[model samples]
Target chain A: MTTRRSVLMGTALAAVSGLALSAGLAPATAAEKELNIGFVGVTSGPAAAWGTSNVRSMQVRADWLNELGGVKIGDDTYKINIVTFDDQKDPKRAIAGMEKMAQEGIHYVVGPNVDDGAAAVRPVAESKGIIYFPYAFPKELYTKPASNAVLGMIANYQSAPAIYKYLKENKGVKKVAFIAANESDPLSQRDGGVAAAKALGLEVVAQNDTYPNDTRDFTPVLTPIIRLKPDLLVLSGVSPGNAPLLIRAARELGYTGLISTETAHDAAVLKEGAGELADGFISVGGASTPAIRSKTMDEFIARYTKKFGEYNDESNTKVYALDYIIETLKANPKAINDVAEFKKTVDTFGAPNPYVKEGTLKYVGTTSFGQKRQLSVPMVVTQYKDGAFETLFVGEVD
Target chain B: MEQVIANGLYLGAQYALIALGLTLIFALMNVLNFAHGQMYVLGGFVTYTIYGQLGLPFVLALACSALTLAIVGALVEKFLFRPVIKRSAREESTMLLAAAIAFLMDAIILILFGEKQRGVPKIINGVFVSDSLVMPYDRILVGVIAIAMIASFMAYMQYSRTGRAMRALAQDRVAAQLMGVNVDRYSMIGFALGALLAGVVGGLLVTITGVNSGIGGPISIKAFLMVMIGGAGVVGGAIAGGFILGMMESVGLNVLREFGDVTYLVIFVLLMVFLSLRPNGLMGKPWG
Candidate 1:
């Protein structure tokens, strides 16, 4: 019943009619809008794991939130989208990454993972009205006249003193020796730890023990430090790659004392590289321990590990940054485009913590940063066993 | 002080193993081989995959690492470096090719390995501590094994037919070719051997220090320092340079404890002064 010419004409006619109808009705119903958040950090270098974890946490939470029909803000509901840039752990690239986010009209951004990166993007963030959450611990970025940056996690200075005080009271630790990789990040953390250690009346021994970041053999580096026999040996801002090697070398050299760091570490890496050598290693654990995890947090961990093959322990703190961004925007929708309103809202902001089982989410650091520019993170210290983290204690930032 | 020597010995073993591979490629090809460290990283990952993930024996993992690197090295020379060396007017142009190869290998490694810090379980463990000398049993075993490998390589070079041919080619490429040697085939084999050495060292050291994609560049820079300290193409010089660096690090960190951040500065100045006095290093001749 159908001829070749007739079928061809009929197909052509249907195509034309469909296009005409869509074009004619295009003006009345508009396309839906989605919110964009940016992540600019070191995702391709030695410090890559932390930045990558930050992005994944942001993505996992954003994806989960979007599946819930998006978040309701004012009278409109919008889904979330993530933008990412790899700064390669360089400061110049970090500035460019910030400029790119600004070009895309993204108001809220997360990270420039290290100290120099966070500092380099400060000017761009201020001029472009972007609010950035960084893990770097620089007082100037959080201090007065610097209003756009917020601390995403606990600074080493804040955690070091708390850890040191607990050690002094419980473990009978009276003397301390500090060692850091001879780089800007670790050196800065070491200096802060030194000041904190001295303030707590703990004697400082062998504070000048620093090694080049590339040194594989800590034998020469740790030999002198071990001779001092300090009750506590503090590895300030040690990267995950170096942690196991350091612990192994120290233990091989007969170091019987306790070892600790302020940065979170991967328990699996510790087990594979250091084995029994890393038995008593202490580090900053997750932002929320198992005792404090909400149902949302458990679901997030399941989805993240499923998507990424494995999970980075540092994600415990990074998972909170995006949700806070969304929640604050919900509190005052005007802050979505205007950072001034966000600043005002941040001062009086108090909401139920989304990832934690209990307690309220609010900005602290009014005294430490001279503004409420830091997220109030639960400080959970953990000790490394075979291939797992056992919670040592949980304390809140003063 | 004795403990410092013990530490230096262990450190020297690692430095020597790393330097040998770089020096061999330089001697054979006159190529700067910037990608040598990436090959080393590839070797480490191969071993990690075999032993750490697949649950194979450590020896089999190491053997596969060596075999994989040798084939890769032979192919790279056949296609990439060999063609570039032929077409370029200046020998220094090979350095550009080497740099490009380094970038290529880095990208390849990143895609495959995913930038994770990978390691294997220790093959042997426990410490051997006596009278202020605290040496891990693994370090002692590794040092002995490295020394044996070096000695075996020397014997092979002195006796084996392929080794003699390769050495003769290094000494005089045109003359060796005229003496009925297959220049192209031997040259490719020589490069493969050099890369194989890198793989072997990487496999050995991965047990001690974890490996990742980001470590490749720094390892190359350190290899360059070792090669410079030694005579550019001399194998014996590489060994000497390794010991010298190891002892310097041990002494600099322990004896010169007060210098803190500036100890490396002092060491660098001393090295510069030494190099200024002897431009050819301890063993290099005028031409080499």
Candidate 2:
């Protein structure tokens, strides 16, 4: 029973079984070469849903591409391997994650999802020639002299003006109030939204209502904000988790004003947290609603839910980042390592968006960052009703 | 102003529930349990599973959460803390262990519960509106439950034999041992009680703000602030600290609404100044 031949056979069988078990976890075969794409972001902590969505979407896409016999770049076909790093929402760890990605020779990265992490990894991404698509909204990150960082989705400043103008024009909204978490991301977004509100000539009734991230009770916070009695209340850059709480608090306090956020929100979460109270709550609800979702989008949602056992609506926008990376690399194979080449193709590069039937994949942000440094995520603002999102209006990023 | 007081009282009731468990453990063992927040989170998640997922009654879910956390606390005290304490007399060792435990619990929480913010259906419907004062019925129920729990805990600690033994141990561990009090059993019980209190608060609060793995650390930090303000290891002081922090937050947020989000910073500064004057806190004496 303990013979060397038997043990060797057992080991061989075990190795084969292990490989078979890890079918979707890694590239299924050694026949195909691998192209490593890095994801460095907070996969844990309070802002987890955002980064988690980013990672899951990329992984599903990578697996899908690999299943389709890999992506072609220049003359070679390489299996897309997503390398993930959980920075735990710490900027220092995000830097370390970027360094680790660089050491692995991965040139394209998906995220450093928050403002601090996005800023922290800038030195590493630039120095290492890593073209990172960060889901962060710092203007400095996407502006000139910051060539490598691309805005992964529509930022608050970009989304707010579109949302505010629509509401003002449609709902006759005159007064706007802004509230934010004391954190940098929310504070920045709040300030950006305030500027946008002022630019639209909407009267700023309340501007500096902020609370700590860990605050559970919002009655005290919102009472003062509600007293201003603006026609609209905006929670700037609120995390997906905190949005419902703020909404619920505001609504329960009998403030009949319309409430909105420029950040992503989960309809299911809103329903569960605020119930029927969250009806008419507006937020950036990604690029598609059930009404506008294409076949490809439906398939992606089904497969993602099957694989990960859950799907966040935020992932609808997140899938675009990796798709952009792979498509850009195919356009200019040299950009696999050099971000400058990627930049050169940004204005000219165009492809059919896989998520939508009639949508074209292109770069935007000419108006926001003075360059095509943002993905043209169809700015779909939505209102939460029951456990689903109803598309309010779809605007294009300038 | 009425709204501020109402908010404070509501906030204070919940905060007191959280601080009770933390202060109780600190009183008996002087272990500044960094993992206390994780325990509370664990409780919330457990309740969520039972109530939100399994469709169990809310009362049953709360009870299960309490039971689960008590067992967890007892095991932690018996295996981790007791072993570490017997092996080493250093306070830093226990502190390190607690931090390690917090990280470990966070990891476990991530693995068991995905990073999604989990919430339950509103236990009750309707709103209570009287002039400028607006409060939800669910919130009122939670506040009442929290106050009831605190009162029950106080009564138990006063009337119960186990409570008296725990008090004796907290007063003087060595002296309690010499007086034929079973130190190890009582210590374990105290730790369990502390963890149970945390669980109860977590379970109750999950109905309101929801629970995520990420909130544990912050919850613990908040609990620490309450303990510091009220005086560490002082149960009454912990309750007092909770109410004080709650009142300050309520008043500060409204009064200084025009001053941006500087309420917490101002409170922190004021607290620091207060601590400098009375190092033992308002009601605490050293480890009180």
Candidate 3:
């Protein structure tokens, strides 16, 4: 035992034994440190596409993380689990879903895609001390400093100004007509657009507040606006189903003026709905066109399309949210149960940071939502051309 | 102004087609078929299945939808309505029955076709572009087809044996029964014709506006409004009401723009006025 050779042999045996012990305990450690994330949104109604895309993307992200030996936090690895509730786009159901998730011990949550659901679920989430990532557009949700919710998508304030600026600088748009569906979010979006257009010195020649969701013939709505002969026609905050039909109706009515929207509808859907008429239309989000997407975005889109049969703009938001959560967890592994620490970490890091390799997210906190919780990514104005959305401009708003 | 008129007239025609079905059912059965709009949506989906998914000719798809709905309508009358009619307390029971049918149809549609809006290729392309106005041929075609179908229906109701029997039943069911008219047979035929009209309109609307399952409720409301404004049991009144409502929407939106969403409020006001001043509606006869 005193010899140098004996000492080396004993040390080697101990190292091997330690390695075996760690290997034996790894499964138990992983089983003990499970993270549950909840998603509450419309998954079974007319707006099902939004929730379907959201859940599928999150699932894909979770699967990828689990495959890579789970999320690493200091010396521990935790398995990521995603639990979902379908709100069917109803506010009462959204609150019920949030309560159910809280009962299930989920502290992290995402979704309530539209305004009503988001508003209804906010207080419930805050009361439970849960971190909520909402895809809604209402600024009031984030205006309160003590709220546990952060907007995971672009706010109407940012989108409206960005869109108006693009139209003014690039298209030389002057007079504008605004139209939207007769829902709370759409109305809010229209008001934002009206204010933005006015602030930018564009005259709002015509505006319509109410178009029903099931409206098949937009001619009654579009004809009057076309008659106004404005330099720009704005269809803001309409559902994916209504947006394209509006475009087709406008084109059929023979208005060649510029058309734009801030709605994050899939360009492929717009193309399918409006066909060749979709060409020359401007919109936010870059899901439909190959020109604006990064290589990583392309791959994600390919995977998403293979799984979901289609790609939507909301998919990008879901992926970014998951990436941000994962990155934040990695930065402060001990922040898992500490809500304040997690919020501080997210607030300090901001966005547009490197997400999954080759992907970057930029979130800006605007005064519009009171606190800096809204995700403010650079606005990408895309024009549909030759059966694809061509990137026209990428710029930021004041 | 010309464009506004054209738009209103076309819209009116569509409303009339949908309302005519509701009026027929009310006239014949003394019960409102709340599921009428679901029938319209189902008709569109059936046409979409035939024309869009199966690669059939559009007209043939329309014909198939109309025929299918006619059979469905007859079955509904024979099985669902006939039993309730025998009970003879249609006010509450039939209302419940219609609502149940509506829910059943909506659930089935949601399960089958999904909530996505389905588009049908325009039967004809191009529009009549002028200095003052633009009109799509699809709109014009819908108007023409509706007018032709309504005219044909009026002729049938006035001349055919079944048509006379239906009118007699509408006037006095007991009297018609005494006159040896087949009440049960005419009721089934009335239901079939009503559903047939909805199917045809639904098929046409697919080409003009596209179709989704969500179209049922709003359409049902509008159809009901048209029936009430035009007079509950009067076909002519239903047509007039549909056109008036269409014109009001077009002109109101044109003049008021954003304020035009209150067009429905205007309709409601007019409805109240009509109820107070002319309770029987524009063309409805007194019950006595």
Candidate 4:
């Protein structure tokens, strides 16, 4: 009887030891699984600002996630790793970067910030069944049917109409003179502006296009436009570097009419470039001033500025993209490994509470794009007034 | 019509100022300094640092920029270009070296000042409005300064001993050396003068437009084109070429709004036609 009892006790002890050993190795294996995301954009060259800001925002988001002990997917916590490539703002380089990313087994890609970069990488992403979030301004990028790409930026059509409407109604602007950089995206924005002006019963007196990248003088372009004497001068789709110079040129040439733009969100840079001339200049889609910002947005701006040394206007959108992905993973952990499941999840995912108040992502299917993959957020019209960006209007585009 | 002409003239003056230094350097060294545009950009930054950031007077800053860049140009010639002058296979290597120097200068400027464009405040504010024409005071100032500098340079080239040596060198290098014109010393002086003009143009441009590191490459291209189109080794030809290009761009942009962005292309085509018709450019001497 004593021998049988001793054998039973030894069997129980061995079973308990095996269970403890398995438990100890479970977390190590889980920790080894990482979710790789790829960032391809212009990290050098003229458009370095866009790429650097995007990367910084993504890094901050990753840091926040890692601090929370990584994102949980299917009871397994996975650290997020961002692999980046600099395309130097060239389309061919962008395509090569995309291919390199695919070879690295990264299925989630963030951006090729400009229109050229986006167009180049779209086919690659679609063919490979990768999830691409592009920060682009063209409708053509999303026109194809049912692709795995989603545009995370406001298209020119949406913002132009709203901006023109505001100017016509509030500022009594009737005749508009339009100037844009001669590029694909800028031309699209110019078309949108023309349409918007026509719809609002406004006359486009002068329409001029300058060199996309190398124009140093706006005087020649503005001289003719100023002669027409329009009520509003629209500098559409110009880069941050050129927009302020355009404004300064106009002001120096004694243009007293209202100046507006679709870009130039960085008020500090604009102010520095244009100085007192930046006063009374209006631009679409920027970070709302501290007075109008929500709690979440304010927190985000503080964190971003602390980390990156400047307040990026697109931080809200970038953070939203990452957060949306995280939330989707939480809903279905298997989606991380399954491309179809991930794509479907993103296509049908509801808007998470965005960082900005009333800044919900609305996926609208348009006749132009024929797809509802374009993410439209609330538009904030900001004016440079008294040495700061003041929120003049906040509403949705009809 | 008045605005177009005024615009053309002022724009021409700027191009002339930018092309002057490049023309001078080519005439003296027979080496196309591809880094000339970077020198222009450096001048602008120096003026901005002195006048904009340091809160010094604008005129003093402009002078300082020109002086500093003259020194820098001399140093570059001595250390960088002087050693390469004697080699038989120097042309390709010198071009590469100029490109490398440009990239290095761009990188240094990028590191020192961030990529954001910074403007120097207008030296004089307000516009002179007329019945049919309006001119900004700062622009008029730029035009006047450009004219004064060009005239001074022309006078110096005609009257001064070093200037006469440079002209003689351009006419016949071997003869000038035989006549006791120290080729090396004159070359350094020529580069310094060219850099001084570039520095002044840069300072003026920062006040007129703005300055960023990226502008170096484009401006360099324009200056190079100006020298080629005007005449390879003639100062007067560079001035004429600058005005012609400037007027063409200004008038072309105003009249051909639809084709405004392609003004550069139009200029290029026109240049091709001109070169085909008169292979020596508008004022260039027939190549040997």
Candidate 5:
């Protein structure tokens, strides 16, 4: 009995020592805490703009955070070191990139805005317990809780509903028509539009779906929509890639109606391709400029212009917002430990959405699960005018 | 509907100009010249460099890019395609390889120039408005230039000695060599002319579509589709195919809501339909 008791004690001691060793070697306890962050994007492809913009935004945010002395974790200053991987818009490549990042000890990642890359990276993020923030608006992300680590800044699939609300209540819009590609994931987002319109006492005049992202000429679908004479012309799933041509086609066909899109935030090329035709088009999403109030936005735009020679866009704001989150998390000593605890802090943490870099940011809630934010309000509608976007509606801070 | 048809026609002519070059190369050498789109983009870039930076005349920029592309084409045919033809086992693989090279070159362009679209100002400025239908004078100018280019191409092929040699080579390269044609020289010339055509078309495209490094792949794909659908073996077939596809795509989308993806689908369907029914394309002469 004595021998057995001693053996049990010895086993307990061994287990305790092993636990102590692991605790000592873990990533959190180091003097200068180093965090590896992975960024997955299409560093090359036709839609490379999406990736490049996001990368630049993240870089700017990181630089700003480090300037303010990195993410503070307890007593240690943890410097965020981002390692980016270019997925080239392929799902297989995106998966490989995520796996490689996970293998390389990346516990946190900012992601691909494109649908294919977003879908591929989500599973890997969940499997590895890596925090993945994607810029895409695929419904599967919100419908199926992949992981607590997986979160989107915006609820992408539900924008049409929000847009429909603004149109009906604010603009007195009664009739609407929809156009989008049938095969694309974003096209499914338009499905909510008809229901939303009907709920708001608006008639759905017509609906037409296209095949690919690059379909430019819109006469066939436009003729019917124009004939229907809907007050609001809704392009629910028009990507920046297709915006130029579709807008141009509509303009060419004498469409002088109020054309609105929820996905119009990133379509910068519309200014060049459609010129004046792109004017008066309003898109519901993050504020472009002037509308968003944040000093961080001003700094971002200045630095982005200095570095990239362009104004800040959605990708820029999102990454900047994330940087603020990371920095705020680091500042709170309670968030430095396990992943679940870190997420709870994130869900509850409220800092100014200093992402706009240009104006004042006021955040409102801890409801991160339902796209509720303590920092940002509903997306403001911005109209394209004189080669720049001007804010039309300021979102209410709830 | 008439307006849509007219618009499609104008767009179709542009496609035809680019497609004709691809068709010419395919007919003579049985190579698609996947880098045709890059050559077109390079033409625009070259023009931008000349007219915008160097302050040269617009016409000179257009001429210089065309001439330079023509020379480059000869060099490419001599170096890249000629060696491969000698050991031609996988023709499709070679085409795909060329496409990969084009992709690499496009990346180089993006890295160098950055991905912003730059416009070259129109040489002529005027508008033709017909009772609410307004067409830019540049469009009219581009259409005229396209017609002139087609006429010159046809005339050269029909009348010139070198053109006849290209025709003979197209008929049967081995047979042409047997008939005292220096096949290598003729092939080089054909490639050069094809490149020259691409350069000019590229220049013309910028007048409407603006120039960006990333436009090559999509443009190349469109050109390829046009050549395949309209026919691939003859110069006329390429032009006809280009115009048909271009117009169809431009106006088809306006007519059909799902027209964007349909354009690509229609091309493949036409290709399959044509292969089973009329294998040589709509205008391609039968090769034996």
Candidate 6:
């Protein structure tokens, strides 16, 4: 009777040890179950295109992932869920979006389209340890505040310098004039323009600031611009409400010079707005020609066109790329979880992607400032001609 | 310096022309035409349809557009304003009704055409260079056209039978009815002529600048202010007031460097001070 009882106890102890080992190995072999993402941006307004496109892109990505059986984690598969709010390009609304997302337990978010919105939401996201991928062009948002939570995708405040260099090297541009609105982005960019002029041995003939945000007429400003007659007119903020007005007035006043504006050669819409006036103008954009070569990009564009009946922009591209990144992370669940792990993983993420183009998509700045995150990402300096944009400069990833 | 003056004058002329129409409607109709700017915008849209879509000559397109809008004005006066006048509705009620209609028109345009500005072809081209002072002849053309239109309009009002009849109607509807003048007919004609002027200004604006969907309300407000500051119910005052406002705007924007903002500020101050000193306006023919 004693021998039979000892044999039964040994069998029970072996069974318990086997179950413990299985549980320990389950995390590595099983799949990730779920992902929650947040989006904050100008979902509406004159620039609603930026925000709406992002939402559509993210939704498409979520659908694609779910169709592929969601992200893989320990033994179970979870679907990606996204929550979005319209910041309307307002800083106050942006902060509210960040807080709401944080409260809802969303650790990942996509955008706050403009600089002001990003700045307002950055601190809140950092304190809450949320990972915010902002798409604004301000430099301070990334480099300052000492937070690992913020990632910027564009060239930041350095686009102006880049543009100036292009002009000097390629176009033999020496004398330049600056015309910008007395607003935050334009004013800051104007400073960069001045710096570029001083650094690159270009003579600054004139620097004029227009009324902050008015479109009644720009003849008051245009007269001085026409009078100075510099070789290049760097229209620092041509996407604003007054851009068309300024351009039209400039043409009317018979001043034909090379105009380099974000609006000058960036989008097809400017071609429609400025008509023949926009022809022969130069501008910088984030996307490179090679980005369109990726099969994934082709698929994305095809899918987006099918779904939304329109092509996407760089902002949409960033959203798609980030969605791709998030899915990648989910595929490797051990890569990031809490703040510290995410910071390290994100830092090592690669450069401005050579394979993404829906519109305005870029990733160089958002990831860490490693060799991979360098600004060597491709950029296009385009000119408007024949009612279309012609590439003047196609930069390569260094 | 010469370029600045020429540019300012050019800009000011366009503003005055737009302002004149608003002032006319207000003085004669005693209702703020909120859609006055929309009428201007509509005028541009019509011209776009004629010149851009239909491929008509620029001048012919502009003329047809103006004429179409004048007819539209007559129809509006007959259906909308005529009823209000016949009912002897409260002044505020009539004004509110006009404002509502303006809102409706703006909404309709926005829904139909989207909020992007349409490029209009430049009407006149050529640079005017004198002593190294260069300015676009297109601007001079706008100013010249504005002056000619105002001069002809003033002359017609002073000499023509229909113009006198309209003036009689404006002076007192009941009194004009007591006279041999057909009050309703004159009112319709007044509204039509007012719309015609606005339509022309709209076309001119598109030629110099460009046309967008959302231009009507602000232009209407500027026109109202001009009439009030120039002198209520005075045709001569409307023209003069427009030029003065234009000059102030031009000087404010170019000379002060804070040109655009300063223009509005100076006008507001001028209006306030003038209102305090002479509420009737600078050249108002005071009845009381």
- Among the numbered candidates, top TM-score falls to 2
Docking quality of model 2: it rates as medium
A371, model 1: CA deviation in Å? 0.6
- Candidate 1 iRMSD in angstroms: 1.4
TM-score of chain B of 6: 0.92
lDDT of 3 by residue, A1-398 (tens): 39999999999999999999998989966467778888998766457767766787888777777877888877877788899998988999999999998898887788888889998988888888777888887767777654577787666677778778777897799999998887788888888889999999999997664676656678877877787889999887877778779989899998899888886666656654677887888777633345545666677777767755556665654666676676676777656776677777765664444333223454456556545575545456677775566777765532
Higher lDDT: candidate 2 or 6?
Answer: 2
How much lDDT does each candidate structure score?
A: 0.85, 0.90, 0.78, 0.78, 0.68, 0.66
Please write out the lDDT profile of model 2 over residues A261-320, one tens digit for every residue. Answer: 988877777877788889999999555697677888999998899998878888878989
The numbered model that scores best in lDDT is 2
Candidates ranked by DockQ, best first?
2, 1, 4, 3, 5, 6
Report the number of the highest-DockQ candidate. 2
Question: TM-scores of the models, in the given order?
Answer: 0.93, 0.95, 0.85, 0.88, 0.83, 0.73
> What is the per-residue lDDT of model 2 for residues B1-288, given as tens digits with 9 covering 90 to 100?
899999999999899889999999999998999999999999999989999989999999999999999999999999999999889968799999999999999989988988888889889988999876889999999999999888988888888998888988999999999999998899999999899888888999999988988999999999999999999988898999999999999999989988888998999999999999988787874232
Q: Write one digit per residue (lDDT tens) for candidate 5, span A1-398.
A: 57988999999999999999997897564666666667887766556666677777777767766777787667767677778998877888888988998798776677776666778777787787666666665646533254433433444334556667776787788888777765544565566666677777788877654545433335444544565667888777565655655666566555667787766455356665566778988875564666565665567778877877665355534554455447545645554434555555554555545555444333332233454323353466778886777777745333
The CAPRI quality class of candidate 6 comes to incorrect
Name the runs in model 6 displaced over 4 angstroms: A1-156, A240-245, A251-257, A262-276, A288-378, A394-398, B67-107, B155-162, B177-193, B258-281, B285-288
Pairs of residues clashing in candidate 3: A351-A362, A352-A361, A352-A362, A364-A376, B230-B237
For model 5, state the Cα shift of residue B14 in Å: 1.9
**Backbone clashes in each candidate structure, one number apiece?**
0, 0, 5, 0, 23, 19
Q: What 10-residue stretch in candidate 3 chain A is worst by lDDT?
A: A350-359
Better of 2 and 4 by lDDT: 2
**Candidate 4: lDDT of B40?**
91
Write the residue-wise lDDT of candidate 1 on B1-288 in tens digits.
Answer: 899988887777788878887887887778888988888898998998898889999899999999999999999899988888878889988898888988898878877877567778887878898887888888888888888888787677668998888787777778889999998898899889889988888888888787877777888887877777877777777777777877777778887776676667777887788789876566773112
Model 1: docking quality category: medium
DockQ of 5: 0.18
**Measured by TM-score, how close is model 2 to the native structure?**
0.95
**Stretches of candidate 2 exceeding 4 Å from the true structure:** A1-31, B286-288
